[model samples]
Target: MDLVTFQNTILPIKDKLFRFALRIVGNPMEAEDVVQEVFIKMWNNRYNMAEIKNHEAWCMSVTRNLSIDKVRSKFRRETGIPEGTDWRDEGLSPHKSAELTDAVSRVRQLMETLPESQRRVMELRDIEEMSYQEIADLLELTMEQVKVYLHRARKTIRQQLIQSESYGLQ
Candidate 1:
């Protein structure tokens, strides 16, 4: 792709790429590095860029692979604990704020417990709000497989959430 095309198309998805990388690596700085590496790789391969049919999916797939590599190189251990959620929305009552925070944290923990493939599909479909076709293209899965994975992931999350609520963990 030309420089103008690259800037207009690839640059606009930087945050999306960062978020995808962060979802895998769980560290902001590492995610940023991964995004930079992805851009560098894309630039280096610019000659073949025109052959790509879906640049966004291509970029996301690269980000996912690189982030997974970074995590694997570190022995799959988390780099650090995430910062605590800030319950600073002035519109919310203190009790409501606490409830929202707790709910979000609980769901995040539940998501982390999922298998890698399911978690990835869930993140792309639900968190990223990507369509099944886009997710399938990125993950190298069929469209039907993406739908199945999403359904199973959501079901697992729902069941776990119900159990947690029944146990007063929520």
Candidate 2:
């Protein structure tokens, strides 16, 4: 794609890519860095861009991989487990912002408990609002497989939340 075409097409995806990176790396600054790096890499490899049938999927894959690498590198230099490890244990109060934040935290925790494939499917689908075809292409799964995993992940989270509610945690 030409520079102007690429800018018009890809610039709109920056927020989504940043959010995806943030979800993976759990750090805003690092996520921004990853998005910038991915965009730079995309620009440098612009010649091969035509070979990519799905540019958004390609970008998401790049962002996810880079975020994972950053997380691993940071872990290697850390002395202990990161904060928010047990973030799911925190429940949402009825207050608006706290409730939303708690719900996000709970979902993140439940996501962490899932198999990597399921978690990724859930993140890309529910969190990032990606289409099934897009998610399938990004994760290299069949569309049906993506739907199945996403369904299962949602079911699991719903059950967990229901159980928590029954226990009067909220």
Candidate 3:
């Protein structure tokens, strides 16, 4: 593809790529770097891109691999909610907003406690809203395996939420 074609076809997926990278790397700045690297890789391989089907999934796989590589290079990483985000809900009362934030935080914490596969599967399936086949393709898992992981992840989170609710949302 030429420059304009590349920009039109490729540039739109940048945000999704960034979000996937951020999900893995857990740092916005690092995610940005990963995205830049992905773009560079895509540009370099632009001629070959047409041979591959499903560019979005291809991009997501690349992002996932690069982010995992980045994490491996670093010593340790603990993250959630990509710090410094302010996603305000204009309709919510302040108290309701606080509750929503806390609930989200709690769910994130619960996700952190899950195994890596389970957490990643949950994020891809629920958060990103990818189809099972797409997830299986990207994660290189069987469809049944993807379903099992997602089901377990949701079951665990649901149970945790129920437990927390019983305890009155401390």
| Candidate achieving higher lDDT, 2 or 3 | 3
TM-score of each: 0.79, 0.76, 0.83
Residues 1-170, candidate 3, lDDT per residue (tens digit)?
A: 78998799888989889878877777777889999999899889989988988788878888999999998876455444456564334335888877776767777779989999988898887878989999899999999999999999999989999999999984
Q: Tell me the tens digit of each residue's lDDT in model 1 across 36-149.
A: 999999999999988988888889989989998998987656444456633224335788767777788678778888888888999998778998888888899999988888
- The clash numbers for all candidates, in the given order, read 0, 0, 0
Instruction: Look at candidate 3 and give me any clashing residue pairs.
Output: none
Mind sharing the TM-score for model 1? 0.79
Query: How accurate locally, in lDDT, is each candidate?
Result: 0.85, 0.82, 0.84
* Candidate closest to the true structure, highest lDDT: 1
Mind giving the per-residue lDDT tens digits that candidate 2 earns over 82-164?
68554322332457545566667676677789887888899888777888998888778999999999999889988998998
Taking every candidate in turn, the Cα RMSD to the unseen true structure, in Å, is: 4.9, 4.5, 4.8
- Candidate 1 stretches with Cα past 4 Å from truth are 76-100
lDDT of 3 at 43: 88
Question: What local lDDT does model 1 show for residue 120?
Answer: 91
